[model samples]
Target: MADQRLERLIRQLQRHTVVGLDTAVFIYHFEAHPRYLPLTRVALSRIQQGHQQGVTSTITLMELTVRPCQLGRRAVAYHYEALLVNFPNLLLVEIDRSVARRGAQLRARFRVRPAEALQVAAALTHGASAFLTNDHGLARLNPIIDIIQLDD
Candidate 1:
């Protein structure tokens, strides 16, 4: 069941344009998250299949920095640096004033979290055609963007 599901996702990601990766996807790039293996693998395959451009908000880097710390400062530093160095294709979209304003409005209107809002904002700012997130709150904001729920 999972294999077929994973394959379908892999195919979809191959044609993705400016994919927006949530914090969960970033974390999986380092140590393994058993539950996220399928999603992560599909994301990676997409990158391999010419979907090289990955859009992520500054907050994702902040959130990702926290998890690697659990492994220790050195490990965190190495992993974070490695990710930045290797993924030149990864675009770090800043959560600037404009994004903040948009996020605030989305929060007021849809009641989504700041982090999720930031992700969507990044995607929109970068002209991303699709958003990759495990966050369910995105369903509410579907009218604004195309969200591909990794958890589903």
Candidate 2:
């Protein structure tokens, strides 16, 4: 069953040349969440292997580092920052004016959080064909960009 799920995820990921990774995906991988780590591992491996390109908003860095910083795990936070910045075939997209405008529209229409909207906006603006996330609310964005839910 695990192998089947992993294979299915790989197939889904292969369908997209560029995939946008959400912050939750990274958190799962970082924490090695038992249920979702396999999925995130496959997704990230595809990017690391150069089979597909990965994109994520800079907001992800902030999200990933906050808890660690709060817990006084500065070293861990720095490690995550370094990994994110230097990850292979992954682009950390900056939030710009165009992204901000699109994010505002998504936020208003979809009623998602500001960071979530900006992440999707960055993905769309940067030519991502699919966005990988665990947040079910983001599934509403399928019409805009394919939303690949980890659990599904």
Candidate 3:
């Protein structure tokens, strides 16, 4: 069943040229979260192989590094930073004015948090046709960009 689900996810991802990734997806993948690892592994592999372009906001970088930094795991934090910076076909986007404006609009319209709104805004700004996330609440953004929830 897991394999079948992963296959379905791959198919869905293959249909898009670019996919937006949320921070939770990376955390699950890095930490090897049992339920989500398979989904994130396949999705990240596709992005790494350049089969799909991947995008995420700088907020993801900030979010990913905080726990490690707080725990005095600077090496681990550096590793993550390097991985994100050098990852192939993955663009770590900065929060620019346009993205901020769009994010504000999304936050107002969807009542999502600022960070969540910025993440979606970055993806949409960068032309991502699909956003891969573990947050089910983000499914509300399906009208603007296809939201692929890992749990689904």
Top TM-score model: 3
TM-score of each: 0.84, 0.96, 0.97
Per-residue C-alpha lDDT of model 2 across residues 1-152, encoded as one tens digit per residue: 88988888888898999999999999999999999999999899899999999999999999999999999999999999999999999999999999999999999988999999999999988899899998999988888888988886
Please report the TM-score between candidate 3 and the true structure: 0.97
Give the lowest summed-lDDT range of ten residues in model 2: 143-152
Backbone clash count for every predicted candidate, in the order shown = 0, 0, 0
The positional error of residue 126 in candidate 1, measured at the CA in angstroms, is: 0.8
Candidate 1 residue pairs in clash (backbone atoms < 3 Å) = none
Question: What local lDDT does model 1 show for residue 113?
Answer: 83
Q: Is candidate 1 or candidate 3 better by TM-score?
A: 3
lDDT of 3 by residue, 1-152 (tens): 89988988998998999999999989999999998898998999999999999999899999999999999999999999998999899999999999999999999998888999999999999999999988889888888899998886
Model 1 residue 18 CA deviation in Å? 1.4
Mark the regions of model 3 whose C-alpha exceeds 4 Å error after superposition: none
The global C-alpha lDDT for each of the candidates, from Candidate 1 onward, is 0.75, 0.93, 0.93
Clashing pairs in 3: none
